[model samples]
Target: MLIVGAGLTGLCTAVRLARAGLVPTVIDARRAGSGTTGHSSAKVSLLQGSMLQRLARHASTETVAAYIAANRSGQEWLLDLLRERDVPFDTRLAMTYAVTESGAKDVEAERQASRDAGLEIIDVGQGDLPFPVLDAIGLPDQAQIDPVATVRALVAELESFGGRVIEGIRMTGSSFTRPWMVSTTAGEVRAEHLVLATQAPVLDRSLDFARIKAYRSYVLAYPVADLLNVPQSMSLSLDDPTRSLRTASTGEGDFLLVGGNGHEVGHGGSTQARVDEIHAWASSHLPVDEPAWSWSAQDYHLTTQVPHIGAVPGTAERLFVATGYDKWGMALASAAGELISGDILGSAPAYAEALRAKGIRTADITETAAQGASVGGRLVGDRVRLAAPGSGQTPPGEGAGRVEGNPVRPTAVSTVDGRTCALSAVCTHLGGVVAWNDAERSWDCPLHGSRFAPDGTLIEGPATSDLEPVTE
Candidate 1:
C-alpha cells in the first residue's frame, strides 16, 4: 500500500498498516509534520465549534450520529497512541461560545444537536473565559496536543513498526492503467492500493477541491505573563470573526494562543490587516505581551459540512481519498486513517461504514451548486475587473501583485524584495484567474483554492502543475 501525504492521516494510516505487518510506504511532498497537521490548533474533541449543528443542517440524524461516532473513535485512537508512545498532551474541557444573537442560536442548536447525536454536552453560559459571552456550551475531558510534537511522535511510531517514509516527494496522480501506477516527482510506482490523505485530495478526478471551501486563519502565541488569566480549556466563539483560545506549554514556557479572523483564502482584502486585527483583539481581551511567534494556517470546509472519505468516483475502488474535515482534521483525519486502513484490510468497523452509507441531501446538492456559482461569479468578476480602462502593463511596488491582459491569457505580475516577475494568472486547476495574496506574497486561486509562491511554484493544489513564468 502507498499512502500519500505525511500529515496526521497518512502517518496514522501508515502506522496502522505497518503494525498489522503490511509494511506500508508513506510519501510526503515536504515532511511528515508539514502541511496542516504541523500548523493545527491540535484540539482532540467531539465538541468542535458548531460542527454538529452545521452537519445537522443537511445530514440525517443517523448520519450525525455516525459522524459523532467517527470522531469519538478518532479521538480515542489518537489519544491512545499518544499515551502509549509517552507523548505529553493535555486533557481539558472544550467549549463553544457566542456573543451575538445569531451566534447564540448556533450555540444552542449545536448543544441540541450534540444531545441528539449522543454527546454529553453542557450549556454553562460561559465557563472560565476571560471575556463575557452571551451563550456557550462545552464537552468535558477533551484533549489538546502540540501538533508538531504529535506528528513527530506519530512518525516515530510508524518507523518503529517497520514502515518506510520518504520526504520531499510529491504525488501528482495515478495512472489510467491497471495495477494502478502512482506518479510522483520521485518516480512512478505501482501499488495495489493508493490513498490520498492530503487536505482536499491533490487529484482533480473527483473535483473534490470544488466541494470544499478553503479558509485561512492566523494565530499569535504570546509568552505567559505573571497575571495572565488563561482559560483552562480549548475555547472557540461561534460568532462571525471566529475566536479560538488555548494555552500551550513549550520548553520556554506556557504561551497563550489567540486565533481567529478567518476568511476565504483568496477573497479577503489586506491579509496583514486581518492579522493585525487578531493581534489587537488578543491584546484587548487577554494578558498578552509581544508575541513569541505568530503564524497562519488554512483549512477546508465542505459545502455539506460533512467530510467525504471514500474512493474517488472514477478510480474504480483502486484509489481512495479523505478530505473535507472543515478545520477539525485533528480528530476526523485520525479517524479517516483508521477507516481507510480498515477498508483496505477488509476490517473497517461499523462507524466507517455508517459514514460511507449516509445519503446526500437536496440541501447538499444545493450547497454544492451555490459554492460552484460563487466560484463562477468570482471568475467572471475578476476578468471584467482586469478589462477595465487602462488595463495594460503596470508594475506593482514591492510586496504587491496584480493581473494584466484579457481573459484569453492573463499574466500575474508581482514585485517582491525588488525582484519583479510576471507569471500566468490562469490557475492550472480550472483556468480561474489567480489573485495575489499580499500577506503571504503568493498567487491564490479564488476558484478551487490552489496557491502559488511569488515565483509561481505550486504551494497548495488541486493544480498539480505550477503557474507558467511569462516573458515580461
Candidate 2:
C-alpha cells in the first residue's frame, strides 16, 4: 500500500494497514505533520456543523446511523489508543452552540435528527458554559487531542510495525499499469494500491475540484490565569460568521484557542485583520497577556457537509481518495481510514454506503462567472483608462504592460532582479482589485487575507500558491 500524505488520515491508514499484515509506505512532500493536519484546531467531536440534518435529508436511516456510529466509534478508538499508548489528550464532552436565537430551529432539527439516528444529545439552558450561551447541544464522550502529538505517536507505532515513512519527497505525478505507479522526486514507488490523502486530490482530474470549496480559518492561543472557570468543552457557533472555542493545557499555562474568520481560499481580507479579530475576541472573553501562537489553516468543505470517502467515482480496484472533512477531520479522517482500509482488505464496512454515496454538489458557479466577468472587465477597463505605451513611458511595473496583438490582455514579465511579476490588477484570491501596498511592496487580497510580493511570491497565505501570471 502507498499513501501519498503523512497527515492524520495517511498515518491512521498506514497504522491500520500495518496491523492488518500490510506494511504501507507513506510519503510526504514535506516532513510529517507539516501540512494542514498539523495546523488543525484538532476538535474530535461527532457533533459536526449542522451535518446531522443534512445527512438525514439525503441518506437512509441506516446510513445515517452508520455514519454517526462510525464517527462516535472513531472517537472512542482514538481515546483507547491514546490511553493504551499513554498519549496525553483532553477527553471531554463537547457542546456545539447556536449563537443566534434564530438558530434555535436548526439546532432542534439537528438534535431530532441525531436522536432519530440513535445518537445521544443534551440541551443546555444555563450554567453549562463559562459565559452565557443562547442554546447549546452537548454530545457526550467527544474529545480533543493534540494533533501533532497524535501524529507523532502514530508515526512511532507505524515505524514499530515495520511501515516506512519517507519525508522531503515530492510526488510530481502518477502513472497506471495493473498496479498504479507513483512518481516522486525521490524515486518511483509502485504499489498494488494507492491512496491520495493529500488534503486535496492531486490526481483524478474528473473529480469536481470545485465541489469542495477551500476555506482558511484563523486561531489565536492565549494564556489566561483563570482556568477552572473556563469550560473544558469544545464548541461551535451556528451564526453566519461562525466561531469555535476549545481549551488546552500547556507548560506555560492554560491556553484558549479562539478560532474564526473563515473565508474561501484566496478570497479573504488581510490576514493580520483576521488574526487581530480573533485575538480581540479572545481578549474580551478572558484576560490575556499575549498570544502564544497565531496561525491560520485551510480546510476543504464539502457542500453536503459529510466527508467524501472511498474509491474515486467511476473507478474500481485502483485509486482512492478521502477529503472534504470541513473542519471535522479528526473524526472524519479516522472514519475515512477505516472505510478505505476495509475496502482494501475486502471487508464490508458499516460506513461504506455513506462514504460511496454521491455528495451534494456545492460548486460556486456564480463565483466562476464573476471571475470571468472580472478578467474581461479589467482588460477593457484598464485599456480605456490608461493610454498605449509611449517611447519613454514604461509599464506600471516590470511585467505591467499590454500585449502587442491584444492590448487588453496583460502579460507577466521577469525583471532583471529575478522576480516574476503579473500584470493583472485584480487579485485572484478574491475579486478585490489589488492595489500595490507601498509599505509591504506586495499585492494584497482585500476581500480575504492573502498577500503576494511584487514578484508574485506568496508572502502570506490563505492563498496557497501565488497568482497565475498573465500570459500574452
Which candidate leads the pack in TM-score?
1
Off by over 4 Å in 2: 358-472
Taking all chains together, each candidate's TM-score versus the true structure is 0.96, 0.80
| Residue 226 lDDT in candidate 2 | 75
lDDT of each: 0.84, 0.68
Give the best candidate by lDDT.
Answer: 1
What local lDDT does model 1 show for residue 190? Answer: 91
Q: Assess candidate 1 and give its TM-score to the true structure.
A: 0.96
lDDT of 1 at 62: 81
lDDT of 2 at 328: 76
Candidate 1 lDDT by residue in tens digits, 376-438? 898888887785432455779999998888766788889999998889899987888998888
